[model samples]
Structures are given as C-alpha cells and as structure tokens.
Target: MGYVSQAESSFPAQVGKDFEEFIALSSVHCDGWGISTNDRQHAHAVLEKKVEAAAESATFQKVIADNAADGALLHLRWATKGLSISENNTHPFVYGDYSFIHNGSIFPPDSFSDFIDEKFKKLIVGDTDSERYFYLMMTQIEKLGLAEGIKTTLAIIKEHGKTTSLNFMLMNKESFVVGSEHNSEKKPDWAPADYYVIKYKKDADGVLFASSGWNQPGWHTLENHHAAIVNRSTFEIDVINL
Candidate 1:
C-alpha cells in the first residue's frame, strides 16, 4: 500500500484504521511485513520490518498506530519461491533516501545484475529478486530521472522476464511512485481475477493506493502498465504510460 496526503505532514487516522483490516489478509501473505513513512523531502523515513506474520506482531500494530507521515508505503510479503523469510529479505528495502517494495517475480533471479550500477549492487544485502529489481531502478534513475528510469526498467523486465506481476511502489522523501504491470493470464491459480489489481482513492485527505484483495468499491483502478507519481509537497499526480 502507498499513501500520499496533502503536502504537509499530518497522519490521517483512517490509514491506521484501514490497515488494521488489511492485516487480516496476511493469512495469505503470511511470511513477513514492513513499512516506511516519510514526512517530507530529505528527512529519514520511519522504517520498520518484521520477519513474521503481520497479524502476530504487536510492534507492527504499535508502529502503525503511532508513526505519522505524509507519505507511507506498506508491504505484506508472500515470499517468492527460493527466498528466505528473514529481516534481510523483508520488504520496504531502504537505500539512501528511497524506500521500495515490490510484488512480483522476475525470472532468472540474477537477470537484473547486468543492469545495476556497481555501487548499487554492492549495497544489496538481500537475496530476493525484489531487492535487485530496486537497484535496477536506482541505477536507471541516476541517468534517466525517476519516471523514465522506472519506465525503462519495466520495459527491460517485460522484454526479458517471465513476470508474474511487476506491481510495486517506490517512494523517496519527495515523491511516491507506483508501477502497475502484470500478466493477467499468469494470475495465481488460487487467487481471484482481481488479485493482481491495484486501486486508489483520493479525497479531502489525500490519495491512498493498494493492491486489490479487500473491499475497495469506489477506488479507481490504476491501469496496467501505467505509473503514477505523487509529488510530496504539492500532492500533484503525474500519470504516465509504461
């Protein structure tokens, strides 16, 4: 889940309330959970992670209940095959000013190595493909800026990977960016048609985005292969095609 409220720093109480309900879905995504909150640009995010089911962690509930942020991203991991359920492999992977979480699989776990910058690759501590995917974007961002970097990375993965879903949220202190892409035909056999769907709701408070699993009747469905970025200070959204 990703949230960007009106510019300034104020924690909307509804996020915590809604997330409490979201945690129940951990029955399916039961490996681990992580969260990152940013109040504004240049400040360190309030990042927390646990290698346990979200519903079982008191710290998870307390962290959500206490921390305040203008922008925040949350993840409940259903560990990809061959990955370990450890803190090192948890979501909301942080690198400098950016926090990232991805929901998908990229074939050939090392497929992104050739694309990552040497320095970024050195920073990787986890063995999950998601962490490598993050570095791939960071490497591209160094040359193409945020949107283009994300676009290029997804394009490359689409061309080379047998992707299940590349849906993800990448946020820094100044912007929250979401990438939505997936092979509808490759949806999990036990999941619903909308299991890979991503949706959002914008109101007087701000915009809230999440993967489709629970009830989100009025939320707008973010189209597949599209990326949306929310400016942390202005709350302006830039919708781009990937």
Candidate 2:
C-alpha cells in the first residue's frame, strides 16, 4: 500500500504525478491499478495495454498532477492466485471509506474464509486472496481498534505461516501498515533483502514515511514487526509494536 498527503503548497500537487512514472517502470505489476483520496473519491482502473501505454507517455505525469489528492493510495498488481486480470481483481480494494492494497498472497483463502463475517464475504467481487485478506483486516478493524486489529490479523497469519506467506501492505487516509517476512521464497536471490522504514518531519505540519530512502536525507528504517503511524498534518511519527 502507498500513502500520500499534500501540503497546501506542496511541490507536486498530486502523488500520482510521481507514481504513474513509478508504475511505468514496474511493468511486472500488470493486473490493475487502484487509487484513493482523503475526500473519498476512490478510483479503481482496469490496467489494460492502453493504460500501461498511457503510464509511459509524457502526459501521464501531468494528468495525474491535475488529479492531485490530499491523501492517496496507489496499487499495481501482478496477478498470482487470481483469475483474469479485470478491474475487479485489482489492488487498493475499498470497503466503506477505507482502501487497502497488498503485496503478498494468503494461500487457501478458503481456510480463513470462515473467519470473516458474511457481510464482508458479500463484498468479495474478485477471486484474489489478497482482496479477501483486505476485507478480513477491515472486518477486524471494525470489530477491534487499529492496534488490536493488527494483533489479531498477525496472529492468524503466524498461525498459518507454516503453509503460506502473508506479506502485505495496507493503508487508509490516515496511516499505512506493512506486513511481511524477512525473505522472499519465490526469489531466492532476495533472501538477504532487508526492509527499512524512514520517518521524517518535513515541517511542523507534515510528516513522511517510506519503505526506502527516496533520495532524501533523514530517512530511517522501521524495525521489523513495528508499525509506523504518522500524524497526517504534523508529519510526526510514532512507531508502535504489534
């Protein structure tokens, strides 16, 4: 999941301005694209050849800047366990006003299927386990507060980790949560890969968090199993343990 909040006079009015270029570089993620804003204008686009082409075009950046949002989440999915790559099988799945995106799979979605409520089950419009996982987390958050919901969700994944990997990235208008193991089983070459989180207080009213150093100084690494919560306005960061 990706999160972006703009200052009143931010340099790039739209986060997608940069993100569309990023997505263009990520041809591997070809399923679909999902976007959300703090104002509740959610967009889920079916990523076809044309979309990819447009993402590569010069106008893509300007168009996204025109659609700038205060806070946004963008997703580019590489279909794994899902069916045909349609708009419905995209990332950044939304429920109510909440939006989520995932990076890893939760195998045997049916195994945890019963753990979710019927109402959430009805929201499953696609065949991806990632979407189900998103709904399950939403359901948990609805029943429990953010912290409790994370703990409960992690517990379920740890219990099932023996059979499947559950690496995920989730976010809403206020914050983002990333879950994953240290290594990638699919690409043995990435076994020693390390994940880091950086927190920054750009100004008295702005904070930023990112997985990697965005070529900016003061980017810090997030500890494993820790959650990074940023005050959307102040950019103050609070790292919480799950």
Candidate 3:
C-alpha cells in the first residue's frame, strides 16, 4: 500500500481503517511486514522491517497509527515456498533514495543473474527473489529514467522468468508507482481470480494505492500489465500500459 499527499500531512483515517482490514489477510501473507516514509527533498528514508505478522504486533499498530508523511510504502509478505521468513527478507528494501516492495514469486531466485549490475548485486541482503527483483528495477531506473526503467524491468521478467505475479509498489522522493502484472493461469488455485488485482482511489488531498481483497468501495482498478506513476508534488498520474 502507498500514499502521496499533496502537501506534508498525515494519511487519511480511512487509510488506517483499510489497513487494519488489510492486515487480516496476513493469515496468508503472514511472513513479515515493512513500511517506510521518504523525504521530500530526495534525502533519506525512515524504515522498519520485521519478521512477524502485522496483525499480531502492537509495534506495527502503533507505527501505523503514528506514521505521517508526504509519501509512504507498506508491504505485507507471504514467504514463497522455499524462502525463509526473517528480518533480512522483509520488504520496502531501500537503496539510495528509492524504496520498494514486491508481492510475487519467481523461480530460481537468481533468474536475472548476469543482467543485474554488480553494484546492486552486492547490495542484496536477503535470499528472496523479491530483493533481487528490486535491485533489477533499480539498475534499470539508473540506466533509463523512471517510467522506462519500470517498463523495461517488467519486460525482462516476462520474457525470461516464470512468475506467479509481479504486483508491487515502489516509491521515491518524487513519486509513487504501483505495478500490476500477474498470470491468472499461474495464480494459486486456492486464491480468488482477482487476487493479483491492484486498485487506487483519488481524492482532494492525495491518492491511495493498494492491493485488492479488502473492501475498497469506488476504487479504480489499475489494469494488469500496467503501471501508474504518480507525481508527489502535483498528484498528477501517468498510467502506462506495458
């Protein structure tokens, strides 16, 4: 989940309400929880990572209640089969001014091996495929600009890897981006058809982007194979069909 306010302000109360509801889904996505607040001047970020269920942690609840920022990212993790649940494997991975969180699994975690820039490869702190995916995106964003970097990363994944979903939320000082890319045929048979769908709601103050499953009345669904790049300062959004 992510939010970008028009000015420096706290998130809407409804966002907090929706998050409480979202946390209930942790029965399945119970591996970990992570969140971060980015600086407005492209400075640094304040982040927290934990290997525990958000629903069960008082600290998580307090942090969510006290969090205030112009831009933020929160991630709930569901450990892929062989991946271990640990603090190091948590989401909202940070590098420089960027923060990222992914919600999918790709086989052979190092699928992007040679493609990943060595500078980023050395930054890998966990054994999950999600961390690797984050670095890959960073590498592209470093090579191309923002939008193109994201698009190119998804292209690389689709062309070479076997993935269940590529749904993710990434934020930096200037913007917040959400990507929804999932193979319906590859989703967990036990999960609902709309499990990978991502949605967002825009209002006078700012915009809120989140995953589906919880009740999100009147929220606009971001299409699969697409990404929404939202400018933090103006709240202007550019939807790219990838």
Candidate 4:
C-alpha cells in the first residue's frame, strides 16, 4: 500500500517539513515517492523517485513546500511483484492534465495489460498494475465521467481480477476522487489494517485524504467500496457508495 495526500488551496506543509515523520508513519508501505502539484489553472508538474534518494533531497522537500498549488497529490509506493524499483514505476502517473496514484495490488498482474485500450497501451511507462489501472481509468473517464468512471473501473477490476485492495486517488486540475476498496470477506495476510482504510476530513485550509498513517485530527475512515468526491474550487466533499 502507498500513502497519498490531495490538497486544495493550501499545501500540507507538514508533509514536506516532517518528511521523516511521514516516512515513519508509512514505513510499512514503502518503495518510491511521487508528487504532482497543480497551479491555479489545474496544470501540474510531477516529481517522483525512489524513497531512499528522494527523502534525502533538500530540493524535493523544498519543491513540496514551495508549490503554492490549488490542488496537489502525493504518493509513497510499495512495490508489487514483477515491477523493478525505478522512477518510471513511481506513483502519480500523469497523462494530459490528469494525475493518479494508488495503494492497492491487482493480483495476477499480467492480466491488467489485456484490459487497456490500444491507445493507452503506449502511454504505459511503468510495469506496476497501478499504471495499467490508470490507463483503464482513462478509458472509463472517456466513456463515463470522472466519478462514475472510477466506480466502473473498480467494479470491472473486481469482476475480472482478484485484488487485495483497490484504493486510489485520481485528480486533474479542477476535481479529484478517492476510493477505499478491498476483499474484506477474505482479506489477504499482506492486507494490513491500513491498506483497507482511507481517511479524510475538512480543515481550516481544505479537505485532506490519506491512508492510515497520517496524523489527521478529525479524519474519518471511508467505508469499504465507498468514495469521496471533492470539488477543488469550492472544497465541497460528497461521499458516495460505489
């Protein structure tokens, strides 16, 4: 599982300043770190690298803090099978104006590629199931809108593959979506408490969504198969069951 933070209007400065604190909290799921901060228009810049090296960079921390973005997404990865540890395999995969990060593993990962549309197959730069899932998401978004696309994508994955978790954060410049999904009836040994839970809450700044490790004061766990839809401009959050 990975950790993600999506912010609107305010940057979670603590995420950058207290990098070690986050590392300690999310150490259970660790591999790479990736972030994409969006500008007023929703355009974003991405930076991702293996954690050991990224955590040591003063530049990385500075970029995280200095970005006065309206919306931002950050991910700390835990490698699944078959993928090598490299920047390409990092989270927060971006295409066009959309950015995505996930915290679940699609079992029998090889089957993921078969679901991708031919147009998106070429966009895949990494071997992680998360990236393939991202492409499938893009295809869904084209057919259904964002929120429904996310729901449909998860449903299709659950129908075709066995996934330990299907949690993800998908965002562009204007809006963002999140989900907390898992095979709760037959939870896998590797699926820790944190993997099945997603927490979020509204603060003075805006809404913050994260995995179990973040020390959020009023955060509430998103129910299984449930999702949170956030409007970046107004900061209104609506919770829906998928």
Evaluated with TM-score, which candidate comes out highest?
3
Q: What's the lDDT of the predicted structure labeled candidate 4? A: 0.70
Q: Report the candidate with higher lDDT, 2 versus 3.
A: 3
The digit string of per-residue lDDT tens for model 2 on 5-51 reads: 54432224322244334555345566555554443244432111222
Candidate 1 ranges beyond 4 A from true positions: 7-12, 16-18
| lDDT (tens digit, per residue) of candidate 1 on 182-215 | 8878888988888888998777778788998876
Candidate 4 Cα misplacement greater than 4 A, ranges: 1-11, 14-20, 42-45, 48-59, 184-194
CA lDDT of 118 in candidate 2?
87
Estimate the lDDT of model 2: 0.54
Candidate 2, RMSD to the unseen true structure? 4.7
Clashing pairs in 3: none
lDDT of 4 by residue, 33-143 (tens): 777765446455454445544455565576655656656677777688677888888888888777888877887664656767889998888778888899999988888
Candidate lDDT scores, in order, read 0.83, 0.54, 0.85, 0.70
TM-score to true structure, per model: 0.94, 0.73, 0.95, 0.84
- Worst ten-residue run, lDDT, model 2? 44-53
Which candidate order results from sorting by TM-score in descending order?
A: 3, 1, 4, 2
lDDT tens digits, residue span 184-237, model 3: 888788988888899999999889988888988889999999999998878899
Give per-model CA RMSD. 1.8, 4.7, 1.5, 3.4
